[model samples]
Target: MSRKVIVTCALTGAGDTTSRSEHVPVSPAQIAADAIAAARAGASVVHIHVRDIATGQGSRDVALYREVVRQVKESDVDPVINLTAGMGGDLFIDPSNPTVHLPGTDLVSGLERLAHVEELRPEICTIDCGSLNFGEGSQLYISTPDMLREGAARIRELGVKPEMEIFDTGNLWFANVMVEEGLIAPPPLYQLCMGIPYGAPADPGLLKVMVNMLPQGAEWTSFGIGRNQLPWVEHSVRLGGHVRVGLEDNLYLSKGVKATNAQLTERAISIVESMGHTVATPDEAREILKLDKVASA
Candidate 1:
């Protein structure tokens, strides 16, 4: 590969992986420290999802986001921040009584989900392209057309790049539709998420097709959760797209070996280098994605 590949570290996802992995960071200070460490390890971007400190569950708290971002910006390393706006869409329903919402249900409007993004205004914020049966339950992650349109319009107004997440072909199709409708700004960034239960499986053929499906000149990255994470780095780089890795997507650096954000990032950098390609810095990544620096807010 002749191009500089951008590596993103997705630290501590909203999932209940905390119970399984001791390495997952839940508090704001820990998340910020992890983000800084990942940046120092050569990651161009840090994709953050705050977790509730008390319960260790995913949170959309602006205060948490503020503290994390503040710490990162004040740190020595400057990595591109990509906050998750994919929260607040979780809807757990009872199969027997479809209308009954389960206890952990967190359904909210799309704009409401952007509370953190609006306040912190990071360089990038992810927008899930469509709704899907998120996992092995009646849980549905909702992102309707009208909701998405409204979010996109607001994100454009704020001048923060929306990192469109493509979990399936349908999501990709709608993202393209959004592009045509002018909801997204130019040189859109896309993150192809795979191996997430009910969404797209971690298949190379499908990944290639999805890459082809992306609009010309789009900056894209791909990742697979669990065991597929590290291998997916190679897969994504081989296809000329960027790569994402970290504890959020995968717990282990190798079999039964837990990994930290920095360890995962170092491995990804090694992969990019082994492939005879350079890994991008934050500024280089910003140039690749055509992003302007968002002031600390």
Candidate 2:
């Protein structure tokens, strides 16, 4: 743990966790406030996913994204913005038909998912590398090679770094293929998502294997959902990678304590610090990721 680790705080995920935790930010203003607070708490980057205010469900509306980004930009802190382009891929297949999607399904082309990234032009945008049986029941997350290729090209053109989201080994394989095909830029970023039902398990050995599989000079991060979140922070740092934590992945700060975004961020910083490693500031993270300097800085 010699180098500074970039801690990303995912404010409010596109999940149905609002009912689970009262701290999950819902409105554009709340989300923006959470981002600022997390940045102040030592997060170098803020991974944002806006929710529909009325239903507390994930949304791909560019207008909603616009408002969130706008508020953050005007705020005091300067954490790097990483918008989630992973929303438009939710697919809830009907149990009976198997072909038709369920009520909560929201499937679209890869390029369509980048509407916010295109308009907002955040420093970093995510590309969920491949499809997955994301969780329990009939839900799936879709992202074909064709869709990914097009999305990568568009993000590259937009001059935003693509944080390759790898749920399993296959996703990593396809991400490498995209990099080799020249769609992804140099020093590609990856996010190894663990403990998500049907994806990779939350095993240290497996995370090491996935980390080894990353292309040379690639910067990556990993996170384990639920109770594994905090432990995964230390795991990622010890493995020479960055880390992410927030209410999006887990709700608890302790055994029964519901955590706020800022509290989760502070706790993550404490973990990194206790491990003899310093946490990166917003500017340092940008330099580490090779992202552009902030405008009017």
Candidate 3:
């Protein structure tokens, strides 16, 4: 049987892309509006990251999250909401003095990071499974084992599916461990993130290996950054995993063509259909992922 692919549009990311792309949604209203558009364009899920309205930088403020969630839920189209709990884990150390933290540092306890999630009660939320060097700096994205267990447990307690964001093989390892330890519920959802700085490189061989390492019966999705975005959509579907796309991963739809969340989602749907697989609806996605139906507003 041909598989049903779930297309998740990462509406806005906590990156510096707002300045680079005119379509990146910065405000809560824009993010929610774009999410609805993506859903109408055939995305079953919408991954969200709220930004500071004044600066267009990633923010973990609960108020911003509340507004975004509110607007998305109130909209006519109902896509599965996947709020990111990956913020508040960034640690940027001073290059000269390693002991001193830099301005970009925003470390917080695990529960604190999920403040919005606990309140909003979205059907799904992301939990970075491990730490990484992050990018071209003294910066690190920390998610220790203890932190992962705590966050996973909290998400489960709230009856929310935790989408484990695996940046590398080691992160996948820990995610499997979380599943084994009963922190992550059955049919764990993993997001095999690729082409992000020093983490897992966007190679077919690496993705194959990562997919093989996943717990049996796990639901997985994959994406690559920049130019690799669309290619990875076909790659993930061919590999029997779902796909993610949007301005968050790539600013351009084609070379020099800036894209919006809706456009990216439409492109993903086209790729899935071209491969003879139907794109899953939000209801079908809920059934596939074994998530509870979201209540209407």
TM-score of each candidate structure, all chains considered together? 0.97, 0.97, 0.97
Q: All candidates' lDDT scores? A: 0.92, 0.92, 0.92
Q: What 10-residue stretch in candidate 2 is worst by lDDT?
A: 288-297
* Backbone-clash count (model 3): 0
lDDT of 3 at 3: 85
Candidate 2 lDDT over 115-215, as tens digits, reads 89988899999999998997789998999999999999989888999999999999999999998898877778999999998999999999999999999
Q: Which regions of candidate 2 are displaced past 4 Å? A: 293-297
State the displacement of the C-alpha of residue 237, model 1, in Å, after optimal TM-score superposition: 0.9
The C-alpha RMSD in Å for every predicted model, in order, reads 1.7, 2.0, 2.0
TM-score of 2: 0.97
Per-residue error for 69 in candidate 2, Å, reads: 0.8
Candidate 1 local lDDT, 244-276, one digit each (tens): 999998999999888999999999999889999
Cα lDDT of model 3 by residue, 1-297, tens digit: 588999999988999998898899999999999999999998999999999999999999999999998998898999999999999999999889888999989999998999999899988999999999988979999899999898888888889999999999999988998899998776799999999988999998999999999878999999999999999999999889999999888999999899989999999899999999999999999999888622221
Q: Give residue 101's error in model 2 in angstroms.
A: 2.0
